[model samples]
Target: MRLELEKRPERSKIMAVVSPIAAVVATLLTGAVIFAAIGIPPLKGLWVFFLEPFSSLWSIEELVVKATPLILIGIGLSIAYRANVWNIGAEGQLTAGALAGSLVPIFANSWQSPLTLVAMLALGVLGGMLWGLIPALLKIKSGANEILVSLMLVYVAQLLLDWLVRGPWRDPHGYNFPKSVSFDGWQTMPTIGDGRLNWGILFALVAAVALAVLLRRTMKGFEIRVLGEAPRAGRFAGFSSDRMVVFAFLVSGGLAGLAGVIELTSTVGQLQPNISPGYGFTAIIVAFLGRLDPIGVIVAALMLAVSYLGGEAAQVALGLSDKAARVFQGVLLFWVLACDTLILYRLRFVPGLPAGETAR
Candidate 1:
């Protein structure tokens, strides 16, 4: 007997809603097993890894802070993926945005006004769009795979950031560290109340709502969905694939760049060799888990943020490594993809032909 997958006549609507939930449950079970294997009590470890993050107000605030970047980037990615454009270099775009945005504060240290912040945010989005445009142009002109081109650019951006912070952008007064000067006054993001929570969360929420409207209530959204589902049909309907590709990349890259700037101005307060904890990469999983919906991304981003807090909690409470967050994220993505597969295909055992006999 041989096993084969048979495609469904139509996608399963029930499974569409259930897959993410099922993935979460499977990941939890797997986490329990992993904890036990590592000689920790399963239940205790689970609590430390999941529930402990919500046990305090401060931790809850941190969750919002972490989720801010994920939501912004994930919303952008959802647009790109929905349009059938694969952009794997959001991380690079984010780095480029950060560098571009920082030029304002780095060079205009004497300028401390609201205009500085405005310029920084605008340049950040522009930088991301410019970086994203490269892969789109290459795909259009040379038929290059966007996946490979975009992913490779990530390393280039990282290296560039490292060089700048370590060489030119390095703070001269701060003893010799690989970081730019601290942002001050209007160069930094405004905060809410007395907490570390900043206006970035508002940006994330606004982006999510705006994109949700765009995807549900706009003709452009129809074009993206049509092109993604059937390229030939889209072409017949007068849709331009090249334009959609550029639009998708620009939207996603711009958001990622905005995210990078928000992280810098709100959280990091300066340019550095590393401004993100894999938020660009993690947003890919967020986009998938949310079923490529902007509104759904908000909830998905929060769940992933919990994993970040959980990892830190586990490190202090259960004596686990901080790498636990990555493991959790990996397992969650694996299960999510597996569950999504079952929504589109069914597995069956088929009887094999006897001795390779030719039958007509």
Candidate 2:
């Protein structure tokens, strides 16, 4: 027998809506099996992976802290994905932003003003946009594959960050650690309480609302949607592909950059060799899981944040490795893509034909 996948003339909107939910359920079920394989009770492991993060106010606060960057980067990725502009280098752009934003803070640490924080954020955005522009411009002018270009740049950015933190930017008196000097009190982000939660959460929320408005209520938003769906139609309607590409890259890169700076200044408070724990890549899943909507991205980001917390909780509670949590995320992504694929195509089963061409 053979199996085939045939595309549908029209996709089911209901299936589109239900696919993500179904994927989540599938992930939970698969996770249960994985836990049971490791000699742990499936229910208890699931609880630790999904529910334990919400058991306390402190954990909830940590969830917000983790979700902050995810939401910020996810929103930016949604913009790019909506316009069909493949920007797989949000990680690179984020690193670029962190490097640029920390320029003044690290090199000119003596300077302190009310505007120091603002300036760093602005620099970060500029850096991210510039980094984003490279692949966009390459794709526009040279017909290069943006997916490849963007992904390659991620390694370059990571190497650059490693070099800086381990070399010139390394703290002078920090026992030879590969990290920049910590931000001073004035440079730190304001916190809501005595915890690590900072004002960045408010920024992410406002950005989400703003992006929702832009996507739903503006002409640019319409252009992005149309261009993504049908480029010929977009061109016929007087939209410029080049313009959309640039705009998408700029907006996406800018947001990612801002997110990098906020994460650094608010959470880490110093430039380091590894400033991000895959926030850029994780945001891609967030963007897709959230259905490319800003509000949805926020919800998706929270879910992922919970996954991280749950992963740690599982490690402490059941002696599972950190890789177990990453496995859960991978499974979730696999199921999501699988569901999306089935949404657009149906399986066709057939019995096997004769082994030889006897008739011919």
lDDT against the true structure, each candidate: 0.93, 0.89
Model 1 residue 348 distance off true place after TM-score fit, in angstroms:
5.7
Judged by whole-model lDDT over C-alpha atoms, candidate 2 comes out at: 0.89
| Predicted candidate 2 versus true structure: per-residue lDDT over 13-75, tens digit per residue | 887888899999999999999888889999999998899899999999999999999999999
TM-score of each: 0.95, 0.92
C-alpha RMSD by candidate, in order: 2.2, 2.7
Looking at candidate 2, the ten consecutive residues that score lowest on lDDT are: 351-360
Best by TM-score: 1
Question: Which residue pairs of candidate 2 clash?
Answer: none
- For candidate 1, the 10 contiguous residues with the lowest summed lDDT are 351-360
lDDT, candidate 1, 272-296, per-residue tens? 8889999999999999999999998
On lDDT, the leading prediction is 1
